[model samples]
Target chain A: DAGITQSPRHKVTETGTPVTLRCHQTENHRYMYWYRQDPGHGLRLIHYSYGVKDTDKGEVSDGYSVSRSKTEDFLLTLESATSSQTSVYFCATTGESNQPQHFGDGTRLSIL
Target chain B: AQRVTQPEKLLSVFKGAPVELKCNYSYSGSPELFWYVQYSRQRLQLLLRHISRESIKGFTADLNKGETSFHLKKPFAQEEDSAMYYCALGDTPLVFGKGTRLSVIA
Candidate 1:
């Protein structure tokens, strides 16, 4: 129930196309993260940003790229969308290192 | 590396019955464990953390370092308690288990 918002709550696109999912926050938190949720896999981090222009890959970052140009915005871009990438993507934000993360409602993406 | 294991994929208990969801982890250094829950049509949220050590919604989780387990328990389950629960470890970036879906029947 934080101020985090993930755009395009539901999206459907064809494979091999480029896609970008946007996460915007109003809390001005210092950390933002992108995670994908799939059956049998609780939630896997794709990328995270500590600050503006500072980002790092996570356990499952092979087909995903991210950018954080501002404190409140983190972008996840898939250069070429694949069917395997179709899943519910969530964005979370935290203010401190050990604080609980506040998650967005999530974006449900589908690739056909 | 930190890894959390949730043995059960699904758990079913009748209302007012005791409930326990098992969770075990593997980590060398000290760990900060947590239990996150997601109700139907709701986003994932923190239910309890080892650091806090406080029960939430009649649920409690004890961190057993010797056993490397943090099991969530409740004396009396409620119908609303039916949801998906995830056990996670770490602070900055958490490592989560596959999750266990609890079904509390009335």
Candidate 2:
């Protein structure tokens, strides 16, 4: 519990709709990351932000986008949602490299 | 490319039995391995890191670079120990394994 919070703990939406997930951190960590958890795939990184306004793609960044306009907030957006995008999403943050990451409760999104 | 591999998808052990979750990684650089656990309805939390070499909640994992393995071990499993465990490598953006679901039966 490193003061990480993810908005929309649960969401249900339809395909082709727009969806955005928010991750807010109180620790003011410089690094933030978004990941998706699937049954057979475990956790796959979607995107990450090393600092405000600086972001990078991860292993599974396709069809997903992220922005960190502020130091305390990182947003993950899906321009057009798909059934394949339905999964439990987790947000993590760390102060420095080689440090253990603190994770948020998670957001469970379902796309129909 | 760095990759973590968890061989078992599910494992069952009776309470008080010894438990071991196998994890192997493929990395050429100096590896920073970690074990994370997620209880039902709870967020994933760090259990232990190879660099620290400390045991948390009766769990210990040793990094064997020669074998490219970092397996989590607990001498006596408890019912509460049942949970989903993930082995991860790297620091900036960890590469996690598929995860292993441990079920400790009474």
Candidate 3:
């Protein structure tokens, strides 16, 4: 796949429960990102990592926390899942600062 | 803050006909733009980038910083080109526009 893969392709959770989604990349890229795709919002960045343990928040980072303990792995955790947080999540990686990103198959999460 | 706008929610064209998907962006600094496509049951993949200036699958896009537009164009669209196309602006984390669902009929 030359690429990344997201775990738990589809998940159904209840409100106030905690959940974690994993994004694993085999490309050895330095930059990784998490984004949520919604109907009217397109894809909004939730969190991103520049290097191992170096992370930052994106436009829609309020309820999401991310960790990049290794170069090939980035994990996004929802402290307390909310129904509003349900959406399709995508993971991406880029080799260059001005290059196009490659995305993984999305994970569909539903918070009940 | 950077933003990408895809004006048309849906665009339809017959096979062998010309097709264009409009995309506009807002950024203060030197910008980078890209186009991504998603076919049914497939992962989102990069189609092209403005910096490369390369044409993929007979499609090309010119980055217009003046108008902040990077429109995807193809002279003769094929049925295989039907997919959800998204325009993004950024190098690391992107600002993506609501995608344009393209349908090419034979």
Chain B, per-candidate TM-score: 0.97, 0.97, 0.96
Q: On residues A25-110, what C-alpha lDDT tens digit does candidate 2 reach at each position?
A: 99999999999999988899999999999999999999999999999999999999999999999999999856788999999999
lDDT tens readout by residue for model 2, B1-106: 7889999999999999999999999998999999999999789999999999998999999999999999999999999999999999975677889999999999
**Between candidates 1 and 2, which one is better according to DockQ?**
2
Model-by-model DockQ, in order: 0.67, 0.76, 0.71
Tens digits of lDDT, candidate 3, A4-34 = 8899999999999999999999999999989
Off by over 4 Å in 1: none
Q: Which candidate is the best by DockQ?
A: 2
Write model 1 residue lDDT over B11-99, tens digit each, in one string: 99999999999999999888988899999867899999999989999999999999999999999999999999999887567778999
lDDT of 3 by residue, B1-106 (tens): 6778899998999999999999999999988888999997678888998889999999999999899899999999999999999998884566789899999999
Candidate 1's iRMSD: 1.4
TM-score of each: 0.96, 0.97, 0.92
**Candidate 1: residue A90 Cα off by (Å):** 0.5
DockQ of 1: 0.67
Per-candidate Cα lDDT values, in order, are: 0.92, 0.94, 0.90
Locate the minimum summed-lDDT window of 10 residues in model 3 chain B.
B88-97
